[model samples]
Target: MGLLIDGEWSTQWYDTKSTGGKFKRSAAAFRNWVTQDGSAGPSGEGGFEAESGRYHLYVSLACPWAHRTLIFRKLKDLTDHIDVTVVDAKMPDEHGWTIPEGADPVNNAETMWQVYVAAKSDYTGRVTVPVLWDKKRNTIVSNESAEIIRMFNSAFNDITGNTDDYYPEELHDEINEVNERVYHTVNNGVYKSGFATTQEAYDEAVTELFDSLEWLEDKLGKQKYLAGDQLTEADWRLFTTLVRFDPVYHGHFKCNIKRIADYPNISRLVHELVAVPNVKDTIDMDHIKTHYYWSHTSINPHRIVPKGPLIEF
Candidate 1:
């Protein structure tokens, strides 16, 4: 809910007034990558080689973007190789995303912003999660979860020996295509609907969101997963959003045109994904509910967290 301006932390919500009441998300500032041979990744500098116990992941369990990387890390069997530090669920006031006392172990820092400041003295931008920190380099390898998951999918294959490719060579084109649509219309759509300041913007966002859901329902009805029969990265990417829809977004974010349960196919798909071996362990309902309700003061002024609609399926 806050941002860094010229490396200084400032508590400010999104200025929807400028965008005609439309909520616009800031692009992630850090886009570095981790490669097998310490070579340069797609965007940032290299020297981040694939080594066991050399990298630590910093994430918010509440964030869907961060959740994707956690799923990838678990699916890739990198749990033993890479370490993790999770921030507290409730991010309040000017102190955005602080690790309450014993929660953070890596730097023992109070705020998540400290990690950014540690990475670059004068960095500026929204401090988001799923930051891949290189222990040896003493810097963040990447803060972009989308790219971070890709790195986890393949970059450290040699070290981990878990080559169950989610983004396979043959299905790359299809997976990318699905990912593009899902990211825009569904993944980010819920946020657009929730944070919209104007009725027009909210209506537009909700329409697009449900439309995409209908499309997904149709697509999933035919195939087993998003990209096809083989469960691809695209499926997991969308799963995070879908899993949270009914529980948090539906009521908390006012995205209640219809629940995920209303769409039988989508609901079934989510349940299937959640049933996946290590996938269930990645989901923390307490974190998901608490973070969304408590973090956004603009949305919920009193910061009163809800405790109903107990999820059964």
Candidate 2:
């Protein structure tokens, strides 16, 4: 919720006044990549080779984007190869993400802002999770979740010996198309709806969100997954958001026009995805519920988290 200003931490929320009450997310500051060789992968500089013990992943169990990287790591069988650290679930925007003092073994830094400070002394951006840190270089490889997951998909095939490709060659175009629509209308749409301060902005976001949901319901009704019958990265990208729909977004974020349970297709897919090996283990309901309800004091002033309406298949 807050961001670093010239390597200095500041407690601030997004000012929706300028955008007419619309929530606009800032782009991730770190964008380096880890390829099989020392060559550059896409954006940032090279020298980040695929090594088993050279990288460490920093994530929040509450964040959907961070969840995607966790799923990829588990699915690709990279758990033994990569080290990971999960931040505390009850993170507020004011102090930002932090672990207990002397808890983190990698950096032993309390706040995520300190991690950014380690990467760049004058860093200026929202300190988001799903940061892929190169332990050797002592800097973040990338904070962009999309790019991080892509790196996990193929970067360490040599070390892990799992060559299963989520982003396949035959389905690249279709995968990108599905990913684009889902990213905007469904993945980010919930935030746009919930974070809006004006009626017009909320209306626009909710309409698009449900419209995309209906489209997904129809699409999933026919195929076993998004991007045809084959499982792809597109499916996992949307899965994190859907799993959270009824539990968090429905009541907490004001995205209650319809729940995922209301749509039978999406609900079934949610169960199926959860049943996937290592996926259900990645989902932490306590983390998800606590972060959304307790952190957003604007929505739940008393911080009285509801106990009923249990999430089930």
Candidate 3:
């Protein structure tokens, strides 16, 4: 809800006035990667080798992006290799993402903004979660969830000996294609719809969101997963959003045209994924609902968290 300005914390919400009521998500500030051999990653400097007890992950159970990294960690058997710290569910405007004093063992920081400041003294960006911190280097390896999950997919194969490939070599083209559409239309589209300040913006975002959902419904009806038979990174990325659809996005975000249950294909897909080992344990419905309803005071002024609409998943 807020960002750091020149290493100083400033409380501010998304400014949609300049974009004509559209929500434009900013790019992540930290982009370094943690490789197996300490080589440079796609975008940032290297020297972050994959080693046990060398890295710590920071996440929020409410956030979909942060949830992806957690799923990957559990699936890849890296739970023993990497540690995590979950921030408090409610993100206040005055203090952003707060944890109890000394809750973060690595940095001993009270707030998430302090973690970003610790990485770079003059950092300036949104204090987002799923931050991969390198303990030895004393800096963040990556804050981009997409890249962080990719690193988890392969970086620690030798250490953990779990080489289950989600992003396979043969399915890269198809997975990337599917991820491109889902990222813009479904993954981020719901956010665009909920945060829009104008009628035009809301209409455009919701229409695209449902269109993509219908497309997914048709695609999933035929195949077992997003990219052919194998479950890939694309499926996990979209899973986080679908799991949250009925619980929060449907009513709170005004994406109520059709719930995930209405689309049988999508519903089946969610159930199957939930049944996956270590996957269901990653979901926390109470945290998911509390963050969206209580944090966005503009959407719900009373901060009343809903109690009904029992979601099976």
Residue 244's lDDT within candidate 2 is: 87
Please say which candidate is ahead in lDDT: 1 or 2: 2
Best by TM-score: 3
User: How many pairs collide in each candidate, listed in order?
Assistant: 0, 0, 0
Over 59-130, each residue of candidate 3 has an lDDT whose tens digit, in order, gives 999999999999999999999999999999998989899876666999999899999898999999899998
Clashes of 2: 0
Winner on lDDT (1 vs 3)? 3
Model 3 bad stretches (over 4 Å): none
Worst 10 residues of 2 by lDDT: 304-313
Question: How well is each residue in 54-137 modelled by candidate 1, as lDDT tens digits?
Answer: 999988999999999999999999999988889899987788888778766667778889888888889988888988988887
My TM-score estimates for the predictions, one after another, are 0.97, 0.98, 0.99
Q: Rank by lDDT, descending?
A: 3, 2, 1
Give stretches of model 2 more than 4 Å off.
none
Name the regions of candidate 1 deviating beyond 4 angstroms: none
In order, the Cα lDDT scores of the candidates are: 0.88, 0.90, 0.93
TM-score: which is higher, 1 or 2? 2
TM-score of 3: 0.99
Query: Model 3 residue 184 lDDT?
Result: 94
